[model samples]
Target: MTMSSLTFLDRERSVAGPGYSRWLVPPAALAIHLCIGQVYALSVFKTPLVARFGTSETAIAIVFSIAIVMLGLSAAFGGKWMERNGPRKAMFVSAVCFSSGLLIGSVGIATGQLWLLYLGYGFVGGIGLGIGYISPVSTLIKW
Candidate 1:
């Protein structure tokens, strides 16, 4: 969890040599979008979550909505921090947050705590999605 570990993600390093392919940038950006954009598919889990938690569909839907809302808020608010620090850091942190949210959400599921599920997946994961979704745009623009 040091900055040095994230050097490979640096914009300059991505094209550090003449052999680097500018053509690859779009695909890389696409991959990022495809990955983070899977949030839309989360609705597929609604029925399963309801059965597992014995909760109403509305509650689960609220969790999904909260995550989306937090995504917007974090992206808007975190843009400046990303610009100041760098996309590499932002992306790495987002990965951590995203993964951490999943892990935390699992704990909630195991313990049957709805609040923990919302805090973990909705709030934390949403922040990760926001930061991750926007992380590569600046780097792509720079290229």
Candidate 2:
């Protein structure tokens, strides 16, 4: 074969076969998970909410509890969705929902609307956490 033809063949083989270094994928996934877990650190937002809205600590705590409960529910029920849709797609969707929740919560805080906090952080972000939590579990298990 010509030099160009040989190069083309090599490229095709790399693309068609197991092209990734399996060792690298796990560490990369770990890094991503660690970063994403910071979502749980959302307690950091509580002080600002309290300062701005003058809401009680118990009320703010309830919001966090609701989000956690929803996260658990979504993970349990959405596992099948994750399985059918594939982890990458599920993760993408989860990230969008999660980010959107933060944005909505910010808007709610700015507007002084407590309900928006519930809708945004508790509901939307909870769903993201749920989906994200499960997205990788089955994938890793299969691997």
Deviating ranges (above 4 Å) for candidate 2? 1-17
* The best candidate in terms of lDDT: 1
TM-score against truth, every candidate = 0.86, 0.81
For 1-143, candidate 2 gives per-residue lDDT tens digits of 45456533232322224576656656756865785677678688778778888998778877788788878998999899877767777787788888888888888889998888888888998888888888667656766
lDDT of 1 by residue, 84-135 (tens): 7777778888999888888888898899888888989989999999998887
Error of 1 at 137 (Å): 2.0
lDDT of each: 0.84, 0.76
Candidate 2: lDDT over CA atoms? 0.76
**Total backbone collisions for each predicted model:** 0, 0
lDDT of 1 at 72: 94
